[model samples]
Target chain A: MRFRVFVSLKPTVLDPQGQTICRALNGMGHNSITDVRQGKYFDISLAEGVAREQAMREIEQIAQDVLANPVIEEYQVELLEE
Target chain B: MRFRVFVSLKPTVLDPQGQTICRALNGMGHNSITDVRQGKYFDISLAEGVAREQAMREIEQIAQDVLANPVIEEYQVELLEE
Candidate 1:
């Protein structure tokens, strides 16, 4: 099994990195692009035959416990069978 | 319409930042986490009535031309209608 996790700042949260990149883009004359938010991706390979529901639960646990600050972030999980 | 662009390093490409994070995770005793990859997400708010296909095309152009190295990174675009 393989899992892909996407964690991002909640919409209400301020993203400084995204703002900086937006400013940089504007400075470089890329006006068409605007208001960017930044996030992180994680790809994990697990042993075969692990159920998607189980994996999701474990990943979500890992997320809330160690991977992210639940107060200001949200996450999505995708399970791929190998 | 709004566009969300996700740009990530190609699977074959080595991700130093992700590797560093993995090391940090291991050092912090999070041994269950493994094989991490890092990427960026952009949330763009576009004027209404733009077609999804058009938004995708422009985003891909921006990605290949300025936002990412096409040879090393891949991108996904999502159109959200408000």
Candidate 2:
């Protein structure tokens, strides 16, 4: 089984990196470009035979405990094909 | 209009950061986990009235020239409903 976990900063948090990108885009004459926000994702692979339900449980735990910093970041998980 | 751009390292490149995460997962007893690859994504907004094809063209150029390190990274763009 495989899963994808996306981690992003809380909306209330300041994202200087994203701001930098926006400014750069504007500087490049992409005047129509209005905003940019950046985030990270992880593609995780699990051994075969891991049941979907159990994999969801474990992957959720992994996303929470290992992939995200709850105080500033949030995460979402999606199951992928076998 | 809004779009999402996902940027990831080429499979051939070594991802030490991903390796560190794998080690941490294994240490945490997630023995079923086989691998993890990390990547980034950007949420970008463009002013309304920009045609889809034109937006795609400009976004592609922005992605190639500003967002991605084409030599080591690749990018995919997804248009989102306004």
What TM-score against the true fold does each predicted structure earn?
0.75, 0.96
Cα lDDT for residue A14, candidate 2: 90
Best by TM-score: 2
lDDT string for model 1 (B2-45, tens) is 67777899989999988886787678765555667778777765
Poorest lDDT segment (10 consecutive residues) of candidate 1 chain B: B43-52
Residue A50, model 1: lDDT of: 65
After superposition, candidate 1 runs with Cα above 4 Å error: A23-34, B20-34
The docking category that best describes candidate 2 is: high
For model 1, residues A14-69, the per-residue Cα lDDT tens digits are 99988887787677765656677778767765555666677677777666666677
lDDT of each: 0.73, 0.92
Residue B18 Cα positional deviation in candidate 1, in Å, after optimal superposition: 3.2
Question: Which residue pairs in model 1 clash with each other?
Answer: none
